[model samples]
Target: MTDQIVPDSEHRGLVARLPQVPRDLAQLARFDRPIGWWLLFWPCAFGLWLAGAGWQIGLLLWLLLGAVAMRGAGCVYNDIVDADLDRQVARTAVRPVASGRISQTLAWAWLGALCAVGLIVLFQLRWQAQVVALASLALVAAYPFMKRITWWPQAWLGLVFSWGAPVGWIALRGDNWEVLAALYAGCVLWVIGYDTIYALQDREDDALVGIRSSALRLGGRVRGGVTVFYLGALALWGLAFWLLRADWVALLALVPAALHLGWQVASLDPADPANPLERFRANRWAGALVAAACYVVGNA
Candidate 1:
């Protein structure tokens, strides 16, 4: 049963210690892979920091909790929806839902619990932010079907995952919709680029299963496609900085993040089985760099 753990689980030891049912539930929510939550949390931080909410540690912590719970809920929902597709993909075939380790009923119950946690976090924000956050539900609900209907599901995911930016911005201040728009747009592109890297791991299986992704659409030009997206993200972020501060010094804040993204693209190896996941996971740091840049530009 321990062997059923997914290959990329970062906390296999912790997950392996759980009882069978609990372990399967944890696997269903992808609790062992913290990357998803981190990715989800960063845009929140980007929005908060860029909105000049200086070190609202308590609010940030609450948002972190929300990120964890909501990311888990999203994964559970995704697994429930994608179980049939998962069964066809080599990497996802052993997933708890697809492998029959967990039932859809149990998964829905778990999703409800996770969303309950998210609901608590939702109350921590202002009413405007609450509405913005609630508005994301429709996007979240639609995401599972994007790959079925379009080649750019990652673009839809970008919309879903980058939503936190607006919520965070609204929570801190109501004005500067232009700044929020630029920041949110950058976050969307960043998600599309990193997720495209992640999708590389499943290209063969996804093609066989008739699933669509930016990775499949780019084909041999995946590196270039990611490069274009990353460059677009940086350009938009730069525009956000200019709109807010109008300083070349403020634009300089983006340098570190730009260099990091450049490294990810320049070093990317799509053909190497291990390489894409490595690069994909590295976006956690990439996101952190951008967050730090946001902090600098917004606070300094």
Candidate 2:
């Protein structure tokens, strides 16, 4: 079998060097794709920083590890549930579960291992945060089914993926629930925007296979849809910053992220195969810019 993944997948050279078993494992957990973890980690960072816990290096590192492990676990679970659907999608047909490189039994074991790491990270947080984190399990478990049932699974993903925003804030301090609510709301809109970009890569396959996605829902209006979502994210973030510190300088901290989002919207091309994935992957930097804004507003 060819060792290559889809054209848009990154870390190809690194993945190519790994042995077969490790490679299969890597594919199962999507370890070769760092963007998922980065997206997941950003919400945690935003929450921590926005709660004035940015200086907690140890906590931050723990959250990063948790993001990696939990994101992997989520991917494993999604692959398991979507194996048949994945076999129908060209890009996902080569996935470990879909390709039969990894059995469902082994995949379940791997998911458990990853969740064990997440549990360790959970132990590090306050009980309030722990409870908040655990509350997301049902949502995560149900996510794969959303694409089967709804035209807006990306909306569900936004809720599940942005969960760390609340966890990070509650872990440090439970006050200012308003700010945390705004931050989580902004992160959800941000996820919806980017995931819509990602769903563009699969619009044709998804439509043919009866899989619903935001890309299919928006169709030619995808760029406009993303623009609205991004604009909503910025607005909510601005509101959060205002609530935190009602100063012009605090709100200005969002400028870099605003510019980056604008670039993404302006340059988006749904018809171009590579355009969507490239724009989707660029959210890692978008996440960083948001994290920076959080730190500046919450601490500076």
Candidate 3:
């Protein structure tokens, strides 16, 4: 297959992230970018903590590694499917596949390699967790086509990206359906909120390319839509705590995260796409705060 990653030669300020792109295939798997992995891993942490306290640190570490590998694998798979589209997006044009840094065949090989690592991590989980984990493959496989078929591709992303939450509960208790459902719901809404912000950055490109996304769907109502989703996330999280015994302290973390999301919306300049991307990426801190809440509640 032809490579489609467009190369940009403007080397100034933040435009230079590509200059230091890792040469090693391993690093190119993007283990260096912890945010993607952190986003994936957070739901798992919350689930594990909610199931019970004092999780094995080593198990958590392995899950982090799993998150890194699986997220990279997912990105590679997406690049393969959307290489042409990525070539057209300013923020994605320099991606490895779009820039010709990685060929299609090599990308497939790398994808398989990452899956192998993912498989090893899966093996470390309990039988129930393994089963829950395998159930996500279909969601992940269909993710690339979501934007083509639905305005809310980010909703589909929530399902795939947050599958770790279900596995987290299974990894610990194997049952407790209520908590699992609540966790999954919270994660889904969380993804929609942040991913809508992410989609804002590509609204023009997506419109030109005939891709659908929440950013396009919400349009001028992005702040309103994001507020709805963020509130939904908080609600589901509250439900999870209620199902898990409504630990009041766990609800406390929602304050800061809510304030942050509120600030993101209130101060949002949707016309300025960069603001949305910055706000979207800032979810790392939000995830951390929620994870802390779970740890405190679970441990308490």
Candidate 4:
């Protein structure tokens, strides 16, 4: 049972302690990997902070809950839709759905339950935020099929995952569409860059199974591709800050995050199997740095 756990699970011990059924369910939802939810939540923070909403503790916590629930639900749905493909991928073969530890029926049930939690979080938001949040459902539903039809599925994931920025921004205020657009665009590129790094882990397996990804599409130039995406993200974020406040000091807030992204790109080693996942996980901190920048620039 312990050996069945995924290679990237961060809470193997706690997950291992659970009984078989619950453990499988937890793995199905990727609760063992909190990084997914953190990545989802940070963009919400970026939107809120950059909207000049100062430390909205209650709303932030609610958004955090939504991120965890919705991200889990998204994973469950993805696994169900991609069960056959997942089985062919070495790293994903152990997934509960792919391994048949959980039936599709049960997986759908669990997905509904997780979405129920997201529904509760939805009710906490204003009507505009609610509408903005609900509008992402179509993109989320279509995301699972993207890998089959498109080499750049990460771009679709970007649209879905970076949605919280607009929701958070609209939740606070309806003005400043330009700043919000810039922020959201930056988030989309950031997701593309990080998710491309993540796709490096499955490039060979993906090719074998006919699954497409930006990493596979980029071939030997993956490092340069990710560099381009990251640079675009930073440039858009800088534009957002300038639109919000023309002061030169506002641009300095992004320097730390810029340096962090630079480091990730500089040290990236796509040849080593382990290096890509490490770099991908490091984006959690990168997200934090960007959130801090958002707070400083928005609040200043």
Model 1: per-residue Cα lDDT over 240-267, one tens digit each? 9899999998988889899999999999
Ranking by TM-score: 4, 1, 2, 3
lDDT of 2 by residue, 79-134 (tens): 99999999998989988889888898999999999999999999999999999999
* Candidate 1 ranges with C-alpha deviation above 4 Å: none
Question: Each candidate: what lDDT?
Answer: 0.93, 0.92, 0.80, 0.96
| Candidates in descending lDDT order | 4, 1, 2, 3
Worst 10 residues of 1 by lDDT: 24-33
TM-score of 3: 0.89
lDDT-better candidate, 2 vs 3 = 2
How far out, in Å, is residue 180 in model 1?
A: 0.3
Per-model TM against the reference:
0.99, 0.98, 0.89, 0.99
Candidate 4, residue 136: the lDDT equals: 98
Lowest-scoring 10 consecutive residues by lDDT in candidate 2? 1-10
- Using lDDT as the measure, the top candidate is 4
Error of 4 at 43 (Å): 0.5
Per-residue C-alpha lDDT of model 3 across residues 1-300, encoded as one tens digit per residue: 112212211122233343433432433455545567888999988888777848668888888889998998998888889889878877677677777777889889999999999999999998989998999999999999999899899999999888888887789886669878988999999999998987887888889979999989888898999999999998898888777775676678568778877887787788874687678768888888777767766667
Instruction: Tell me how far candidate 2 lies from the true structure as C-alpha RMSD in angstroms.
Output: 1.0
Please give the RMSD to the true structure for each candidate, in Å: 0.7, 1.0, 3.8, 0.6
